[model samples]
Target chain A: MFEVENLTKKYDGFTLDGVSFKIERGYITGFIGANGAGKSTTLRSMLGVIKPDSGKVRAFGLDFEKNEQEIKNRIAFSSGAFDYYSHERADRVAKYYSNFFAKWDNEKYEHYKKVFSLDGKKKVRDFSAGMKVKFSLALALSHGAELFVFDEPTSGLDPIARDEMLTIFQDIVADGQKSVLYSTHITSDLDKCADYILFIHEGKIILDGTKEDIISEHTIVYGEKEQAATVKEKAIGIKENAYSFSALMKKSDAHSLSLTQEIPNLEDIMVYYSKGGKR
Target chain B: MSKNLKRRGTLCAILKKELFLATPLPFYLFALLGLMTAIPSYPIIVGIGYVALAIFNSDGFRRSNRDVEFTCTLPVERKDVVTSKTIFVVVIELLTLVFGVVGALLSVFLSSPNGNVVGLDPNLTFFGVAFSCFGVFNICYIPGYFKTGYKSGIPVLKGTIALLLVYSLVETAVNVVPRFNVIFDSLWGDFVFARAIVLVVGVIAYIILTVVANRIAQKRFEKVSL
Candidate 1:
C-alpha cells in the first residue's frame, strides 16, 4: 500500500494543488481523468521521476525521500512515454535492468516473456504496444515489486488485449499482498475490474472511494429538455440536448426525484464531470 | 547515509548500463585520435572528438525517444543519473589521454613532429590544454543537457565556443608568442618539467570543473518533469 499527501507541483499555467490519495493492498485502483488532468504529473512525482515542489509520500512503511531506492525496488513503474532502448533486444535490456535489483529473477522474466509470446532476441520495436507493456511488467515483476504503478498502460491496445491486461492485474494482486494503480481515460476497463476508483480533474482529485461506493452515491437523472432549467442549478453536471437532458447529482441532492434515476457508471461519472462539474 | 548501504544496486550498476547503452565509437576513435597526434603540421585537435562525443550523445542516433524517462524508472537516484553520465564522459577523457600519450611517445621515438604547426606541441603541455578544454566542455555541456534532460545541442555549442577560445588562446601564447618556449623543448618537447606543471594544473582544473558540472546537472535534472 502507498499514500501521497498534499503533493503540490507548479508550472507556468497549471498547478497540481494539494493532491492527496492512498491505495490499499490487494486492489486495482483506476485513476480516471481527462487529458492533462495532472495524472502523469502525480505519478511521476510520486515515483520521484520528477521532483514535486512539496509532498509527503510513504510506502511499505518507508518515507520516499529517505528510502527512495529501497522503495523503488518494491514498486514497478511504467509510463506510456517510456520506450527507450527500443533497438536493444529484450534479453539485453533485462540483463542490464537486472543488475540494479538484488531480487531480480531472470527465471520469472523468462516465464512472463514466454507467456506474453515475446521473443528474447527481438528488439522492443518488434513487439506491439501491448507486448511492450507486458515486457515492462515482466521486468518489474522479476524485480519483486509489490506495487505496480502504470500510466495509461491500456491506451492504444485492442479491447481483447486490454481485457487480458486486466486479468493480469487481477492475478498480480491475487495473493492479497500486491497492489495495482493505473491511470486511463478508458472508464469501461475500470468498470470491469477496478475495485476502487480515483478520479482526478484539473489537477485535483474530485472523488475517490470503492467503485461500488462511488457509483451508489451518484445517479444520473434524465428528463425532457423543458425540465432542464429546474435541475440545472442542482445537478453536479448536466448534458442537455434539444429533446432530453441527463443530469448527474447525489441521490440525496437530486431534485428531479420523479425522473428516472440511472446508476452512473465510471464513464458516466467522468463524462458528467468533464461536461463541467457543479453547473 | 545509513540507509544507503541497504540499497541493492550501487553506482557500478548504473555505470555498467551506461557503457552498454553508449556507442562503441569513442573507444575505437581513441586509437585513431592518437594517430592524429602523429600527423605533422596539424593542430592537436584531440579535444575535438571529446566535444563531438557530447553532441553525439544528445542526438537521435545515440539516444532516442524518452531515454531519460526510461532511465528515471530504474532503481537509481536522480543524482546517480547525472553522476553516471559524468563518469562516462570522464572515462572517455581518460581513454583519449592514454592514447594521446602513446601517440606522443611514438612521435618522440619515430622522429615525427607531433602537430606543433599552429598549436602547443604534442607534448605533456598539450595534454594540459586538452584537459583544460574538456573541463570547460563538461561544465557547459553536461549541466546544460540536464537542464531539460533532452537538449544537448545548445550546451555543446556553448562548450565549443568556450573551448575554442581556450584552444586558440593557449595555442597562440605558447607557439606564436616568444615568451613560452622552455616548456616545449627544455627537457625534450613531451618531457619538460615545466610541461608537467601545466599538466598538473590542467588535471586539477578538470577535476574541479567536472565536479561542479555534476552538481549543477544534478540540480537541473531533478527539476525536469521527464
Candidate 2:
C-alpha cells in the first residue's frame, strides 16, 4: 500500500543513495538498520517531514504532495514518543487530534485506551517509556488508520513490553486489511511478528524480501580460525576470533564451501552485513 | 467549492489545535502583562514589548515541545503548519493589543496630560507605534525561527534587538522631531488628520508585514528537515 521510489537525500558527509522499497498490505514490514543508517532519514523523506533532494512516495494510490491532507488523514504515524503537546492529558490530546481526521473513532479510542490500560487523565510526561509507545499505538489505531508508520516504537521498552508491542502489531494485521511499516534497530521484536524485512546498510537498501526467504537464503559458516579462508572465499561477510570464526554466505555458496553451516536469524544478518561499514 | 471548504476545515481545525493544544498556559499569563499599559509614567511601549517578549519566549517553548515534529504527523501540509503558527502568534498579539487599548484609555486620565516626561505617551499614536513594533518583530522572528525549525534562542535574540531598535527610533523621533507633533495634535489639524492616519497606516502596515512574514515563514519552513 506504500512505496518509496529512488529516495535520495544528501548531507555534508552522508547520502541516502537511491533508497527504495514497497510495503505490502496486511503485513508488517520491519525496516531494520543500525543507528544513523539513514532509516530515519528515509522515513522522514517519504513522509515529507524532510523534503527529499529528489524522490516520490505514493501511498494508497495517491501522490504525497498532491494529496497530503487526504493521505495523511488515512495514515497514522508516530515516532513512538508521546512528546506532542506533552503537557496535556491523553484524553485532551485525543479530543484535539480526533478533529484532524474524518475517520477518527471515539469508541475505538476508548476501547484501545482500556486495552492498553492508559490513564486518560494523567499527563503524558508522567507515563513511562513503554506506556508512551502504547499510547501512540492506541491513538494510531483509534483513527481507523489503514497504514501505520512508526519510527523505533519499541526502542527503550522492556522485553515484556516489546512483546506486547509485537502482539499489538500482529493483532493489527491479523484481520488481513491493515499494513504497518516500523523502523527499528531492534530485530528481536520483528522476529516475533514481522512478515517482511527490509534491511538497510548505510544509505542503500541492501536486502528486501519475505522474512522466511531472506533467512533461508543465507547461512552462517563457522570453524576453527585456521579454516577461516574456506568460508571467507565464498562468504559475503565474515568475522574471526583468535580461536574460531563465523562467516555469512549464501546457502548455495556455504553448501559448496564444505564448511559447517548453521541457520541465521535477523540479528545475525544485521551483524554480518553491518561489518562492511559505511558504503 | 468543496475543495476550498475542505481546505478551510483543515485550517480551522489546526488553528483550534494551535490555540488550545500547542500554545501553553504561560503564554496567556504573559499576555496579562499587556495590561501594564495602564501603569502611569511608563513608556507604555513596554507593554508591547511584553507581548513581543512573550512571542519570542514561546519560540523556545515550541522548540522544546518539538511542535514541528509533532505537527508533521497530522493531516496537514507543511504550509498549513506554518500558517497556523503564524496566526496563533498574531492572535495573541491582537489580544495583547486589546488590553493595551483599555490601558491606554485609562492612562489618559491617570497619567500626565502633556504626556509622560519619560518616553512616548500612552496616546493614540502609541498604538500606531505598538503596531509598527510588533510588525518589525513579526518580520524578524517568523522567518528566523521557521528557517531552522529547531533553534530559537539566536532568532529571538535577533528579533529582540530589532524590536528594541524600532521602539527607540520611533519614540526618539516623535519626542525629538518637534514638527512631527502633528501626529499627536488635533484630529483635523493638518496632514489629513494625523492621528487617524497614523492609526490606519500602522494597522495596515502591521497587517501587511504580518502577511508577508507568514508567507516567508511558510516557504522557509517547507524546506526544513523535521
Candidate 3:
C-alpha cells in the first residue's frame, strides 16, 4: 500500500541516504531504528511532510507529490507527540478533524473513545502520555483509513498499555485489507504484532524481511573468548565480555561449527546490529 | 464533494482550529487598548493595538506548535495552510480597523456637538495608517513565520523596526519639512479627495502585501521540515 524509493534528505549533521522500503496490505510492517537513525525523517518524507531533496514516495499507487491531498485523505497518521490540538478538548478536536476527512465515522469515534476511556471534555494537554497515545490512535482509527502510519505510538506507555495497543494493531490488520506502518524503538512490541520488520541503523536499511524468516535465519552463538575470535570474521554482529562472547550468525553457519546456539529474538538481533554490525 | 469544495472545507477547518487556538486574550486586550483612541493625540494607541494584534497573531504557530501536526499529518496541502492563515490575519486586521473607527467615532461624538476634534479627523487617516501598518507587518511576519514556523523572531523584529521607521519617517516629514507639511496638510489635513486617494493606496498596498505574503509563505512552508 505504500512504497518509498531512494528517499534522501540531508540535514546539518545527518543524512538519510537512499532509504527505500515498501509495506503491503494486511500486515504490520515495523520500522525499527535507534534514536536519530532517520526513521522519523523517512516517515515524514513519505508522508510529504518534509520534502526530500530527491526521491519518490508513492501511497496506494499514487505519487505523493502529485496526489498529496487525495492520498492523505485515505491515510491516517498518528504520533505520540499529540501536537495537533493540545489546547482544545478531545471532542472539539474530533469535530475539527472530522471536517477534513470525507469518511469520518462519528460513531466509530465514540466507540473508540469509550474503548480507550478518553474523556472528550478534557484538554489534550491534561492527558497522561499513555492517554495521549490512545487518543491519537482513536482518531486514526475513526477516519476509515486504509493505511495507518504511527510514529512511536507505544514509546512511553506502560507494559499493560503497550500490550493493549499491540492487540489493537493486530485487530486492525486481521482482515487482510488494512495495513499499518509502525515506527518505534521498542522491538518487543513488534515481536507481538509485526509481520514484517525493516531494520534501519545510521540511515541505512540493514535488514528487511518477514519476521519469521529473519528470526529463523539468524542464531545467537555463545562461547568462550577464543571461539568468538575464531568466528569473528564470519559473524554478522558480535559482542564481547571479560571471559566469554556472543555473536549473531546465520543458523546455517552455526550448524557447521558445533557451537551452542540460542534462538535470537528481535531485540537480540537489533541490539547486536546496532552495537557492531557492519551491514 | 468536488475537489475544490473539499479543499475549501479543509481550509475552513484549519481556519476554525487557528481561531480557536488563538485564545480571546489578544482580542480583549485589543479592545481595551483601543479605548485609547478616545483621546485624539493618542491615536498612536490604535496603531499600538494593530501592532500588538499582528505580533500575537504571528505567534500563534509557536504558542501551540500547530505547524508540525498541520504540515505533517493533516490532509491539507501546505498552500491551503498558508491561504487559511492569510485569510485569518486579514479578518483580524479588519476587525481591529473597525474597532478603531468605532472608538474614534465615539470620541468625536463625546468631544463636540459638530463631531470635530481639535487635531486630525481620525477617519480616513486612521484606516490609512492601520492598513499600512498591517501591510508592512504581515509583509515581514508571514514569510518569516512560514519559513521557520515558530522561529520567526528576526522577521517579526525586523517588521516592527520597519513599522517604526516608516512611521518616524512620515512623522519627520510632516514636522521637519515645511513644504512637505503644506503638501501633507493639503492631502491629509482636509481634502476629501486626497484622503480618498490615501485610503485607496492603503487598500491597494494591503491587498498586494496579502497576496505576496501568501505566495512567499506557501513556498517557504512547503520547504520547511517539521
Candidate 4:
C-alpha cells in the first residue's frame, strides 16, 4: 500500500542515502532504527513534511506530490510530540479538524475519547504526556483512514499505557482492511505487534523482512574465546570477553559449530544488525 | 462533498483555527487607541500596529512549535494553508479600515468646532496612507513568513522600515520637488475626478499586491520542509 524508492535527503552532517522500503496492506510494519538513523526523516518524506532531495513516495497508488490532498485524506498521521494547538481544549480541536476530513466520524471520536478517558473541556496543555498521546491517537483513529502513520507513539507512555496502545494498534488492523507504519526505537513494542520489520542504520536500510523470519532464521551463539576465533570469519556482530564470546550467525551455519545456539528476538536482531551484522 | 466544497471547508477550518490561536487584545487595544486619538493619521498608526500584532502572534505559534504540528498534520494542501492565512490577513485589514473610517467620522462630528477635529477630506488622506501601509506590509510580510515558516520577526521589521522609508520619500517629493508638488496638489485638491482616480488606483494596487504576495507565499511554502 505504501512504497519509497531511492529516497535521499542531505543535511550538513547527515544524509539519508538511497533508503527504500515497501509496506503492504493488512499488517503493521515496524520502522526501527537507532537515534539519528533517519527513521523520522524517512517518515517525514513519506508524508511530504520533508522534501527529499531525490525520491518518489507512492501511497495508495498515488504520487504524494500530485495527489497530496487525496492521499492525505486517506491517511492519518500522529506524533508523540503533540505539537498541535496546546492552548485549546479537545472539543475545539475536534471541531476544527472535523471540517477538514469528509470521513471524520464524530461517533468514533466520542468512542475513542471515552475509551481513552479524555475530558474534552480541559486544555491540551494541562494534560499529562500520556494523555496527550492518547488524544493524538483519538484523532488519528476517528478519521476513517486506510493507513495510520505514527512517529514514536509509545515513547513517553507508562508501561500500562504502552501496553494499551499496542493493543489498540492490534485492534486497528484486526479487520485486515487497514495498515500501520509505526516508527519507533522501542523494539519490544514491535515484537508484540509488528508483522514486518524494516531496520535502518546510518541513513541505509540494513535489513527488511518478516519479523518471524528474521527472528527464526538468525541464531545467537555463545562459546569459548578459541571457538569464537574459529567461527569469526563467518559470524556477524561478534562480541568478545576474556573467556567467552557471543556472535550472530545463520541457523544453518550454527549446526556445524558445537556452540550453544539460541533464537533471537527483535531487539537482538536489531542490536546485531546495527552493529554491522550481515542480513 | 465535492472537491471545491472540500477545499473551501479546509480553508474555513484554517481560518477558524488561526482566529482562535491569535490573541485579539492587541488589535482591540490599538483600535481603541485610534478611536480616542485626535490625530488625523491615527488610522495609519493603528493599521501598522495591527499588522505588527498579527506577525507577532504568528511567530509565537512557530516559537512554541505549534504551527508545524498544526499545519503539517492537517489534511490540506500547502497552498491551502497559505491561502487561508492570506485571507485572514485581508479580512483583518478590511475590518481595521472600516473601524478607522467610523472612528474618524465620529471624531469629526463629536468634537467642538474650535477643537482640532478633522473633516472628511483629511480623513480620506489618512485612509490613503493607511491603505498604502497595508499594501507595503502585505508585500513584505507574506512572502517572508512563507519562506521562513513562522519566524516572521525579521520580515515584519524590514517591512516596517521599508514602509517608513517609502513614506518619507513620498513626503519629500511632495514637499521639495516643485513639479511633484504641483501634481500632488492637483491630486489633493477638491477635484472629484482626481480623488476618484486615486481611490481606484489604490484599490487596484492593493489587489495586485495581495495576489502577488499570495502566489509567492504559496510557491515558497510548497517547498518548505516542516
- Choose the strongest candidate by lDDT: 2
Q: Which stretches of candidate 4 lie over 4 Å from their true place?
A: A277-279, B21-37, B40-47, B62-65, B109-122, B177-193
Candidates by DockQ, descending order: 2, 1, 3, 4
Residue pairs in clash, model 2: none
Off by more than 4 A, model 2: A277-279, B182-192
lDDT of 4 by residue, B134-174 (tens): 77778898899889676778878877776676556655665
Off by over 4 Å in 1: A277-279, B1-8, B22-31, B46-50, B53-55, B58-65, B108-115, B185-191
Show where candidate 3 strays beyond 4 Å: A277-279, B22-32, B43-46, B57-62, B110-121, B177-190
lDDT of each: 0.81, 0.83, 0.77, 0.76
Which residue pairs show collisions in model 3?
A: none
Give the TM-score of each candidate: 0.93, 0.95, 0.93, 0.90
Chain A TM-score vs. truth, each candidate: 0.97, 0.96, 0.96, 0.95
Structure candidate 4, residue pairs in collision: none
* CAPRI accuracy category, model 1: medium
lDDT tens digits by residue: candidate 2, A128-225: 89989999988899988999999999898899998988999999999989999999988988888899999998899999999999999999987888
Residue B166, candidate 1: how far off, in angstroms?
1.3
The DockQ assigned to candidate 3 is 0.62
The candidate 2 chain B region of ten consecutive residues with least summed lDDT is B184-193
Worst 10 residues of 4 chain B by lDDT: B114-123
Candidate 1 residues B1-226, lDDT tens each?
Answer: 3555643256878887776664445443643564566555556575445545544553444456466677788778888888988887787777777877776666665444333555555777788878898899889988998988777788878887888788778867766656586455332634477788888999999999999999999998877876
